[model samples]
Target chain A: MFKRLFDWLRQPLGLIAVGIVLLTVFSLAAYGIFLTQQSSAQPIQFPHRTHVGFGIQCLYCHPGAARGPSAGIPSQAKCWGCHQQIAKTQTSALLAPLKQAVESGTPIQWVPVAMVPDFVQFNHRAHVAAGQNCEDCHGDMTLVTIAENPQVFNMGWCLDCHRKAAGEDEAKLLKLADCGTCHY
Target chain B: MNSKIPEIKLSEEQTGKWGMVIDQDICTGCQACVAACAMENNLSFVGEVDAGYGRSMHWIRIERFWEGEYPEVKMTPGQPMMCQQCGSAPCEPVCPAFATVHSQAEQLNLQVYNRCVGTRYCANNCPYQVRSFNWRDYVRPEPLPNQLNPDVTVRRMGVMEKCTFCIQRIHKAEDKAKSEGRELTDGEFTTACAQACPANAITFGRIDQPESLVSQLIRKHGHGVKHLEELGTLPSVTYFKGG
Candidate 1:
C-alpha cells in the first residue's frame, strides 16, 4: 500500500514541479520585456520647445557637439549668458529653481539623456563630420516638448546605421557586430 | 560557429594594402594617441599601485623600444603599438570563448570585452604584449564625466580590453555616409591616433581601397613589416623604419 501511494505521488507531483519551473521562467521573461518597454527614466522635464522656439540651435546648449567628443552641457554660466540679460529674476516656476543655481555660480545637475554602456566608443566630432544631422540620432527634437526618450540607442540601431553607411561588404567596410567596430 | 568565416569583406589580393606609416623620425611619444584611445574606447585606468602590478589598462601603448649604450646612447623613438588585427591572429583561436574575432572589412581584430570571462588566454598568446587587464573600477572625477565620449562605453573592472582600431568612430562615420547616401571617402574616417598625430606620421583609411592614403604611404615607404612576422600572426599593422 505504501509503494502504491509513492508511485502515484511521484508521477503527478513530479509533473507539477516541472510545470511550476517552466511557468516561473516564462513569467520572469515577460516581466523583463514589460520593464524594458517602460523606457528609460528622466530627471528634469527640460523642454526643447521653449528653447527651440526662441531660435536656439542644439549647439547653443551643447556647445561642444560639433568640435569635440562630448556635447558640453550648459553650466549655470551658460544659462545666465542669456537669462541674466533677459529674465534677471525667475518669472516662470521652472526657471525659479535654476535661478539660484545660475546666479550663485552653481550648476544645474542635469542628468544624461542618452547613456551608452562602457566599452563602446561614440564621438560627436566624427558623426558631425560624417554629415549626420543631430536629429538623425537624437530624433526630431523640433516636435519634442519635454526631452522624452525618443531614440532607441541600442546596438541594433547603431549597427543598422553603420551597415547602411559602410556598405554590406564585411571585408572592405564594417558591420555592427564587428567587435572592433563597437567594443574597441 | 564557422570560425573561419570572414567577419568583414575585403579583397585579399589588393596590392599596396592601405596601412599606417608611423614615422619614428617624427614620433614625439606624446601619448596623445594613448589618451585619445582611452577616452574613445572607455578604457579604465588602474592607479599607480595597480599599474605597478601590471594592471594599468592601455589599448594603444607607446612602447619605447630603445637601443645603443648608456652615456652617448640615444633613445630611438618608437611608435605606439596595439592589436595588429592580423589576417591570421594568434589571439583569435586561443580564446576559449572566442571573445576576440577578425573584422571582415579592414582585417581588424575586434575584441568583445563583454563576452570575455577574463581567462586572459589571448593576452598570453599575444606577441606584442599589448593587451591590458583592469584590476579595479575607475571613475572620471565629477563634472569631468561630461568629457567622456558618448560613442564609447566605459569598461568596468576585471575585464580584458585591447585596441579596437577605433571601430566605433569608423561606424559613426559610416552612419553619416549612409545618411548622405555616399560611399565613405578616404580620410573621412580616421583613428584618433591618425587624427591627433601632429607630424602627420600616422595614416588611416580603408586598406582595401587602392588609392587610399594608407595605400599611398605603403608605396612610398618600402619597409612595411608586421611586429612578429615569424609567429604567423599576419598583423594588419605594418611598421616602417625611420631615416
Candidate 2:
C-alpha cells in the first residue's frame, strides 16, 4: 500500500498533493511552535510599574511565595481592595476588566509568565529563606506592564546561580547540587 | 542527579543518612503501606489485567511465604519491600540515562522521572525488584484525579518510578525546620508508610544520628539483616525477621 502511494506520488498530480500535504504539516507544526513561544493572553493589562511605583511589594500580591511552593496569584478581592479605593479605577480603560470582574464577583485571569517544568519541585519558601529577591529570577517588575520572563528558566540557568551561591559552603553546595533537593 | 559531593564508600561503619528499620514480625501484610505509598506518590493504578501480568505500579509491596508442608502450613510474617536506596546501588550504574542515580546529599537512590526514558535498564539491574515502570499513562477517571498530591510530579507514560523515601515529606519537614531556625528532631517527620503502618512495623529516620529512633531500634535489635547483602549493594533498609 505504501509502495503504491509512493508510485502515485511520482506522478505530477500526486506530487502536487504530496507537496501540499507536506507544506500543510510543516506550517501547522511551525504555527504550533510559534503559538507556544507567544506569551499567554491575560484578561487585564496589569501595570506592574504603577503598583511598584506605589512601593507595593511582590509578596503583598503573591504572599504564597514566602510561605510555600507556589507564589499564588492573588484573589480578585485582593486586587479590588486597592483598585476600588483608586479614583481612576472607575474610568481608566485598562482598569475596566478589573472593575467588571469586581462588580460581577468574577476573577480576572492573570497569566503566569514564569513557570518551571513540572518535574522540578521548586519551593518559593526555600529560595525566599535563602534571601533570593523576587527580581533575581523574575526581572525588574517596575520596568514592564505585564510580567515577562527575562531569561529561559532552564537547568543550566538555574545551576549557574546555584553554583555561584554555593561558593565555599560544603554542606550548602552538596544540598544545592543534589537532584533530590529539587527534582523529587 | 549526580552531585559534586564526594561519594562516600559504604563501609561497615558508614551508616546512611536516611534509613529504615522494618520489623517483619509485627507487619500485618494489610497493605496499608502499599496504599499509602500509592496515594502519597501519585502512583497510577493499573487494573487487574495489567497487574496480573506484573505491571502494577505499587512503590511498596507486601511479600509473604508459606512455612512447612501444605497440611501443616503456616503463613510467615508479612514483609514490606521497597527501594533499598542502596549506598552502592546496582540500579545506578546500569541506567544509561542517569535517571536512577544516588543522591549524595540525601544518601538515597533517586529516580528522576523526567530523566527516565523508559529503557528499564535500572529496573532490570535492581536487586530488590522495587522499580516500577510506567507501561502506559494509567487513567484515574473523574474525582480520583483531584486527589493527586500537588507536591509530587504526576508522571506520564514511559517513565520508571519507585519509592523515593517520601522525599516530598522530607523536604517539607526540612523546610519547616529551616524556617524555624532549628535542626530536624527525631519523630518530627516520617515517610507515608511509617505513618500509615497500624502495627508500627516500619521505623524511618536518620541512621547517621545515633540518637535517632531508627538507629536506636537498630542498636536495640542487633539481629536485623539487610536482604541480598552478599551482593555488596549496601542496602539501607534493615529487616528484622520476626520469629
Candidate 3:
C-alpha cells in the first residue's frame, strides 16, 4: 500500500492538482489584501461629482467645517431637505436607502473615508479659516466616484506643510508643529 | 569651560510665558481638581491594588503634611502638586526618546505620548515627583469611558503622563482666537482644575502680561514662591503662601 502511494504521488496528474491548490490559496490572499487596502463598502453610493456639478459646496453638506473641529456628516434631515424634491422617484435602487432612511427616521451610517488617529486633534475650522481648501488635504473630491482618503495624515506629512508655512508666519506655524498642538 | 551658562533669550514671538498661581488660602482641599483633571485628560483609574503599589495616576495631587507637636498639632492645608512646567526642566534632558520637552511656543513641558518608550528616567530625575508611570494597561470600564474628553488621548500602558496645564483647552482657545484674527484674552481659557475649582483658587494666565489676573495676583502678593526654589527648576506654577 505504501509503495502504491509513493507511485501515485510521482504521477503528473497528482502534481498538477497540488500546484492548482497552492495557486488558488496565494491568489485569494493577494485579493484579500488588495480589498483591505482599497476603500471599504459605504452605506450609500454618494456621488460627489453630481452634487458638485449642481453647484453644491462641500460645506453645504458638512457645515461643521466652518464652525467646529469636525467636518461632520450631514444629518438625514439635511439630506432629505434637498433629496425629497430632487429624488421624487424613490423606486430607483440608488435612492432606495435614502427613502427607507427618511421613512424609518434612521440616519445613514456612512463609512468614514478619512480617519485621523484618536490622538490627533484636527480642527477643520482653523484650517478653513487659514485659507486652506478641502482639496488641499482631501484631494479633488469632485472627480472621485466615491470619497477616499487620498492623503495619509501622518506627523511627517503635517510637518512638511507646517515647515513651509513657518517661513512666512513663524509664530502661527510654530504652534502648529508643537506636540501639544494636535496630540494634547 | 565658562564659569556660567549662556543667557537664554526669549524670541519676539514668545510674548506670553504661560504660568499658574494657586491661592493656597482658598483651596478647600476637596480634591475636586484631581477628579476634574483625571476626567478631562482620560487618565486611567488604577484599582486599589495597583494604587497600593504606587501605580495610581494623578496629574495633580493634594499633598498634605502635619505641622507642630501633640497638643498644638495642625494639618497644613493640602497643596496641589503638579508638573511645574519648569523653565529649566530636569526631566527634559533625561528622556532618551525626547518624549518630554519644553515647548517655547506655549511655555509648557509637553509629554509626547507617542514618542515615549516607558523609560522612567524622567520620573526618576524629577525632584517634585509629579510624573506618573503606567505599570499596567488600565481599562476605562464601560460608561466611564463615554465621558472622556475626545480632545485628549487615552494613554496606554508603559507611558509617563503629567500635568499639561490643560493643553487641550489652550489649543482650542488659541485656535478660536487665531481663526477670529485676534489674541487670546485673559480669563478666556483656563486649566480644568481652574475651571472646576469652587473657591476659584487656581488662576492660570500669561505671566508676561502684567495686567493678567495671574500676574497681578503674583504682584499683589509678593509672597508667591516655587515649591522647591532652592533646586532652581524655575517652575511656572507659583504657590501663594497663606497663614
Candidate 4:
C-alpha cells in the first residue's frame, strides 16, 4: 500500500498533496513558535514610560529588586496610593481597571515579561548588588509601556557578564562560573 | 570500588571548603536529620511501597546496624549517612550529560538538575549510595506545596538528587555576609540537619578554617572515618565510630 502511494506521489496531483502536507506542518510549527514568543495579555497597561517620565524610580514600585530573589509586582494598594492622588483616576479609560481592582480589593494579575526557567534560580539582589542597572537585563523601561526583556536570559548570556566581572581574579571566576552558584 | 586508586591531595590546610563532623555516639536514630533534610531540600516522599523498594527520597538517613546472634542481638548506635560532598567524587566522571561535576569554589560535588537527562549513570557510579533518582513526579497536594523551601528546586520525575550539605543555606549566609561587607563568621549558619539535631551530633562549618567549630571538632577527634575512603572518593563528611 505504501509502494502504491509512493508510485502515485510521483505524479503531479500527489506531488501537490505532499507539498500541502509539508506546508501545513511547517506553518503549524511556525505558529507554535510565534505563540511562545508572544507575551501573555496583562490585566493592566501599567505604563512604565509614563511613570518614568514623572521621574518615579523603578525601585519605587518594585522594591524587592534590591532586597531579594524576586522583583515582585507592586500590590494594588501601592498602585492606588499614587492613582488616588491623580485627577485622571476618576475618568481615564486606561486607569479604569486599576480603579475597579482597588475598589474590589482584588489584585492585578501581572504577566511577567522577563522570566527565566524554574530550574535557573535567578536572584535580583545579587544582580542589583553587582552594580547592574535595572535597564541592563530588563531593557530601558523609560521607552516602553510594559516591561520587555533586553536579551534572552540564557546561560551563555549570564556567563558572559560573570566572566567579564571576574576579569583576572581566578577565585571570583571560579565562584561565578560554578554551576552550583545559580543552580542547586 | 577500586582499591588501588590514589586520593587527590588538596592543599595541606584545606580539606574542603565545607565539611561536617557527625558524632555517631550522640545520635539517637530519631530520624530528625532525615526529616530536616526532606523539609530543607523539598525532597519528595515516595509512597510506602516505593520507599520499601528503595525509592525513598530522603537525603540524610540514619543507619543502625545489628550485631551478635538472634537471641542476644544489639542495635548499634545510629550513624547518619549523607552525600559526603566528595572532593574526588566517583559520580562526577560518570555523568554523560556533564550534569554532575565538582564545584572548585565550594569544594563539593554539584548535580545540575537542568542538565541531567535522567541517565542514572552518576547514581550508579556513586560509592556511598547517596544519590536518589526521582522515579515519578510526586505531587505535593495543596498546602504541602506551600511548605516547600523556595531556595531549593522541587525536583521533577527523572532527575537525580542528593544531599547538597544545604548549599542554599551556604549561599544565603554568604550572600548576607557579602551584602554586609564582612566575611562569613563561623557558626553564623549551619545545615538543616545540624540545626535540627537535638543531640547536637552533627557539626557543620568551614573545615579549612582551623578556628571554625567543625575544624576544631575534627582536630579534637581525629579518629573519625570517611565512608568508603578506600575508594579514593575523599568524602568531606567525617563520622566518629560509636561504641
Candidate 5:
C-alpha cells in the first residue's frame, strides 16, 4: 500500500493536490495566529524592558489599575517627571518624542496592544483587587521589547481560567460562566 | 384576559431583587429618560427614513395614547415603556441561543448581544414590544460616537437589544461595593433613566428592602400596578396610576 501510494504521489496531479492541501493547512494556521496575536504600533517605541528593568512599578505609570475600570495610560506630565532628568543625560533618538511631548505639553497617542472586544466589560480594578498581577494577563513586560497580547481574549480562554479558579463548586462555576458576569 | 399579576417572592440571599416604581403623575413627558437611555446604552439612531419604517431604537419610549377626539381630544399621560424586566419573561424561553436569560442575582432580563443570532424570536415573543431589532448597521457618524457609554456594548446589526435596567450601573455599583467590602447602599446607584429624570418619577432600588424608596413607593401607593397584568408577564416595574 505504501509503494502504490508513493508511486501515485509521484504523478504531477497527485503532487499538485498534496501541495494545495499543505498550502491550505499552512494558511489557516497562519490566519489563526494572526487573529489571536494582533498588535498595534505605538507612537513612541516604549520599551517595557527598560522601564521594568529600572524597577518602575506598572501601577506607577498605570495608577488606575487598582482604582478604576481602565489601567490608564500615563500622562505626558507623569512621563516628564522622570524623562526630564533621564533624557538630559541619555540623549537618544527614542527620547526625542518624550522630550517633545513634555516640552509641547501634548499627550502621546498610544495605540493599545491588549484590547478585549467592546462587549466584554473588563474591570482592571476588580482584577487587581482579586490579587491578580498585571503580568498574569499581560505577559511579562520585562521580557518583551514591544507590548503584545500574549493570550487570546476569546470566551474559551477566559472560561478556562474562571473555571479553574471556581474549582468544584457548581454555583461558583455558574457565576463565572454567567453571561451577565462579563457581557452585561 | 386573566387580569391577575402573579406575585414574586423576593429572594433574600440574592444580591438584589431589583425593582422600579414609575410615578405616572410626576412624569412630565419630557422624554429625558428616552434620550438618556439611548445615550447610556449606545443605542443606534436609525435616522428619519428607518424611523418612518418603525425601526427606531429607543429603549425607553414615551407612549402617548389619545383617549378623546376633536374638541374633547384628551391625550392620556405619556407612559415611559421600556423592558419591564419581567419576573417570567416571554422573551427568555423563545431564544433558541439562550441569549435572553433571567439573571437570578439581580432579577434582570439580560440580553447577551454576542450570543444573539438575530432570530427575532425573542422580539416577537415580547408582549410589551420593548425589544428593538437593528434593521441595518446604524451609523454612529463621527463625533456622536464620542458620547457612547464605554461600559455598554454598541450592538451590531442582526442583534436583538432591549432595556437592561442599566445593568452596567448595577455591575459598577456591585463592583464598588465588593471592593469596599460592604453592601450597596440604596440610592448609591440607579439606572440612567432614573438618574436623569427631571421630575424624579422613576425610583429604582432593591424591592426586597422594605425601607428602599421603590419599596416604600409601592407600599405607600397601595401596590403600583403592572402594565398589561392580564398577560401574566409578571413585570418587575410597577407603574403608579395617577388620578
Candidate 6:
C-alpha cells in the first residue's frame, strides 16, 4: 500500500501535472510584467484642488467644456490671466515652471493621463449640459489634489453611467445609450 | 399643409423629427460641406490616390453634374448627398446584420459599427451612394492628431460608415436642452455641413415640426423630394432644387 501511494505521487503523469501548476503560477507573475510594459503611466500631476479651492469651477481650467467635445486645457496665457499678479514674486516649485511658460508664451506640455481608446467618443458638453456634476464621471475631483488616472474609463464605466441615467425617467431622451451616442 | 402651423403627435415624448433642407440655388459646389462633414464625422482621408479609386469616404459630397462641356460648359451647381433618414428606409431591410436601424424617439438611421460585418450590401442598396467603407486605419501625423474630436470615433479598417446627421451634435444639443428643462432651439443642433455652408443653404431641424424650416421649405419646394423617391428610400434629407 505504501509503495503504491509512492508510485501514484512519483509517476511521470503526476510530475507532468505538478509542472503544469508551476507553469501557470509563473505565467500569472509574467502577466503583471506585461501589464507594466503596456501601461507606462507617468502623469504630469495637474493640481485640480489648488485651482478649484481658489474658487475656480471645472470649466475655468478645462475651458470650452461647456460648448465643444473637448474640455480644452487653458492656454498658458489663461494661466497668466490670474497667476501673473497673484504669485508674481513667489518662486514656488510648481509656480516657477508655469510662470515661465506663461511669460514666454510657451505652452505647458500638459500630458493626458486619462486616455480613452480612439473608437470611443466621449463629449464633455453632453455630460456637463445634462446636469451631471463633474463628480459623476470624474469622481469627487474636489477631493483630488492632483489629477491621476483614478478610474478605468473603459466601455463598462461608460455603459454603467448610461444605464443608470437611462433607467431614471427624469434624465430625458439624450441620456439614453443610443449606439450613435458614443460610436458615431 | 399649412407650412408654419404646428402638428401634434401623442405617441411618445414631445419630440421633433430632426431634418435638414439644402437649397441648391445657393450651393456653390465649393465642397465646404464635404470638408466639414469629413472633419465632423471623423471620416478618414485615404490620400489622393485612394480618393481617385473612389475609396474616399465623404459622408456629405457636393456632386457636380455638368450640364455642358469646355468654355461653353454651364456647371449647374449640385446639392450635397448625405444619409437621408428616409421614413421608409431601403437600407434598413437589407442589412444581413441589423447594424443600421431607426431610433424610436427621433427619425434618425443609427449606424452601429461594432455590429456591422462589412457585407457592403447596405452600400449597394443605397441609391444616394452616401455610405462609406473604411479600407484601412488612417491616422493623421502627430501634432495634427491632437486636432481630432475626442467625441467622434476614428473608424478602423473594413467597416461601413456614413453621416448620422451629426447625431453627436444633436445629442449634445438634446442633453443641453434636457438639462435646462426645455425643447431644443430652432438652430441649436445644426450639423457641421449645415453650419459650414457659406450660403446658409442647409437648414437642419425636425420635419414633423410644421413650423420648422425643413417642413416650411418642403411645403414651398413641392414637398422637396428625396433622390430616387420612387424606390421608396424615404430619405430624411429633402433638397430644394433651384438655379
In terms of DockQ, the best-performing candidate is 4
- Which tens-of-lDDT digit does each residue in A1-184 have in candidate 3? 9999778867998788888999999999999999977666877788888888889999999989998799999887898888878745366788788888889999998888888887678889978887889999999987876787789889899889878867678796767778878776
**TM-scores for the candidates:** 0.61, 0.88, 0.89, 0.89, 0.85, 0.69
**Could you give candidate 5's per-residue lDDT for residues B1-243 as a string of tens digits?**
878766645422223379888988889899999988988989998999999998899899988888877889888877989998887789999999999998765678999989999999998989999999988998888998889889999889899999988988988999899989999999999999998999999999998788888888877998477887666677878887674
Q: lDDT by residue for model 6 over B1-243, one digit each (tens)?
A: 657744432222213377778888888888888888877776777999888889988888877776766878787767788888766667777988888877665668877787788888888888888899988787777777766765677777878998888877877787778657798877676889988889898888887788877777777877465677666555666677762
DockQ of each: 0.36, 0.59, 0.61, 0.70, 0.53, 0.36
Model 4 TM-score? Answer: 0.89
Task: Return whichever of 3 and 4 wins on DockQ.
Answer: 4
Off by over 4 Å in 1: A1-184, B1-18, B69-72
Clashing pairs in 3: none
Q: What Cα-based lDDT does every candidate model obtain?
A: 0.72, 0.89, 0.86, 0.88, 0.85, 0.74
Error of 3 at A64 (Å): 1.1
Interface RMSD of each: 4.3, 0.9, 1.3, 0.8, 1.7, 3.4
Off by over 4 Å in 5: A1-39, A87-90, A168-174, B1-16, B68-71
**Distance (Å) between predicted and true CA of B24, model 2?**
1.4
After superposition on all C-alphas, the RMSD of every candidate to the true structure, in Å, is 9.1, 7.5, 4.0, 4.7, 5.1, 7.9
Write model 4 residue lDDT over B1-243, tens digit each, in one string: 658756555333446889999998888989988898899899998889898999988788887789999989999989899999988788998888999989988998898999999999988888778899999999888889998999988889999999998999999998889889899999999999999999999999988888999889877887778887767677888888753
Clashing pairs in 2: none
lDDT of 6 by residue, A1-184 (tens): 9998778869999788888999999999999887864523323356677677778888777867787667776777887777668754356765777767767777788767566666666777777776787666666677675565556797777877777767756334453656666666
Order the candidate numbers by lDDT, best to worst: 2, 4, 3, 5, 6, 1
Q: For model 2, what is the error of residue A68's alpha carbon versus the real structure, in angstroms, after optimal superposition? A: 1.8
Best by lDDT: 2
**Per-residue lDDT of candidate 1, residues A1-184 (tens digit):** 9998667758978778878999999999999999976534433466687788889999878967776667877777777778778763458776775787866766667767766776665667667876888888877776776565677788878877876777766653444446665565
Colliding pairs, model 4: none
lDDT tens digits by residue: candidate 1, B1-243: 657854544423332233455776778889888887777766665768877787788888888755777666777676778777667778888888877776665467767778788888889988888988766677667776777766665666666777767767767777677657798888887888888778776777766676887777767776666576666565667667665
**What is the lDDT for B238 in model 1?**
62
Stretches of model 3 off by over 4 angstroms after superposition: A1-33, A87-89, B1-16
